[model samples]
Target: MKFAHDVIRKPVITERSMEGIADNKYVFEVAPNAGKIEIKKAVEEIFGVKVAKVNTIKLPGKWKRMGVYRGKRPDIKKAVVTLTADSKKIEIFENMM
Candidate 1:
């Protein structure tokens, strides 16, 4: 079994993700192999909040070129975690807002 920290790689702090905080939703960059069930448990364990829903998006790597070379950005998996209505806000994001 993966540890909570291993499942949740990092919080995504983009403008869109930050906007979600107001609605009790937060975005995270998670392990590529992680599923919704693992994500739900990780969030709950890390933040001590009840998760109401978890939505994931798999982003394919993009191709890029430099003068004479080409490379692809690494693929990524994102998770949008929604907390229960009665749950408290995640403290980490609170200071960011």
Candidate 2:
């Protein structure tokens, strides 16, 4: 697999994701075309951490209503990377005032 920089774009920050990260797991909104192996490689390389496990989920697009037309949200892929106990940390929020 290619290095993480070419696979994962960036980490996703949100309420739920922050909660997970606080528990020692990090979440990211990965490219829809990326898979588990790709995600694993990306996280390890980009974060400089030891990836113990990788989990992926594909979220279906949501339907939206319009007066005379309808639209759907784009599908997205999510990855949860679990790091080794002694791996380096990713401090998402250092100083936000």
Candidate 3:
């Protein structure tokens, strides 16, 4: 079994993600098959934050139809993790020049 910090990718940057961060939470798009424990571990290892709680959401594939073709958007798994009150801030956005 994987610890709660090995399957996280990076902090996702979106309007919704920014909103979450403003509320003291961080958002990430995780491996589709990863569980909560793995996600938590990955976040900790990558960001060096103490995870206080983890919430996951599995988005269903969306249908798409076109002329002579039909397919669906890929599904995605997302996680929202809250950090401990005393944990340092994670600088996901840095100056890159």
Candidate 4:
């Protein structure tokens, strides 16, 4: 059983993510080991919002070469959490506009 805090690493703030806020959806950088259900529960508990849906994206690591050296970027996982229609807006982005 992972703690709610551990399930969600941090909020993902980007142009696309910011746009989602207007639709009662928020983006988060969740733990790679977390699943959709865990993400939904964690977000609901931490933010006090009713999560209606949870969409996840898994970004694979990319390979890079520099001066005959090869390196890989770290893989990342993100979750797009959509809140229920009647839920209150998250206060964190209340004044972002």
Candidate 5:
């Protein structure tokens, strides 16, 4: 079993993600192999909040090239977690807004 920290890599702090806070939705970068259930559990365990829904998006890696060499960025998996109506807001994001 993966630890909550392992399942949830980090919070996504872009402008688009920040806008979700007002709707009780938060974005996170999750392990590529993690599923919706795992993400939901991880967020609930780490934040102590009830999760209403979970949506995931997988972005393919992009290829890049240097003068002589070529490489690709690692693929990313993101999860959008929506909290239950009565759940308290996540404090980490509260300070940012």
Candidate 6:
């Protein structure tokens, strides 16, 4: 198993993610190759919460062209972690204003 630090890169601090905080759901940006199981383990290990469910999405890379040059952005993997009702809350989101 990969280390928690390696599996979960960081919390995704977006307006949409913040809205989920009210529902015991947290968003995180994970490694491109990571799966839902890995993300669940990482979130559990790092946040000490029981993950009730994990939903993952792979954002397709976007293509951009500039001055006859074209490049594609790297794909991103995101995980939405839903904690069990009995689980403890992650404190980091509490202080977010």
Which candidate gets the maximum TM-score versus the true structure? 5
RMSD per model, one decimal = 0.8, 2.4, 3.1, 1.3, 0.6, 1.2
1-97: candidate 3 lDDT, tens digit per residue: 6544447655678777776665568888888899887777787787787999999999999999998899999998889888888887777643210
Tens digits of per-residue lDDT for model 6, 63-84: 9999899999999999999999
Residue 47 of model 4, lDDT score: 82
TM-score of 5: 0.97
1-97, model 2: which lDDT tens digit per residue?
4656657766777777777765567888888888888888777767678888988888999999999899999998888888788887776633211
What would the TM-scores of all predictions be?
0.95, 0.81, 0.82, 0.90, 0.97, 0.91
Error of 2 at 42 (Å): 0.8
Tens digits of per-residue lDDT, candidate 4, 1-97, equal: 7999999998887788889888998988889989999999998898888999999999998999999999999999999999999998988777775
- Candidate 5's error at 86, in angstroms? 0.1
What's model 6's overall lDDT? 0.90
**Per-model tally of clashing residue pairs:** 0, 1, 6, 0, 0, 0
> What C-alpha root-mean-square deviation, in Å, does candidate 4 show against the real structure?
1.3
lDDT of each: 0.95, 0.77, 0.77, 0.90, 0.96, 0.90
Better of 3 and 5 by TM-score: 5
lDDT of 5 by residue, 1-97 (tens): 8999999999999999999998999999999999999999999999999999999999999999998899999999999999999999999999998
Give per-residue CA lDDT, model 1, range 1-97, as digits (tens).
8999999999999889999998999999999999999999999999999999999999999999998999999999999999999998899899888
Better of 3 and 6 by lDDT: 6
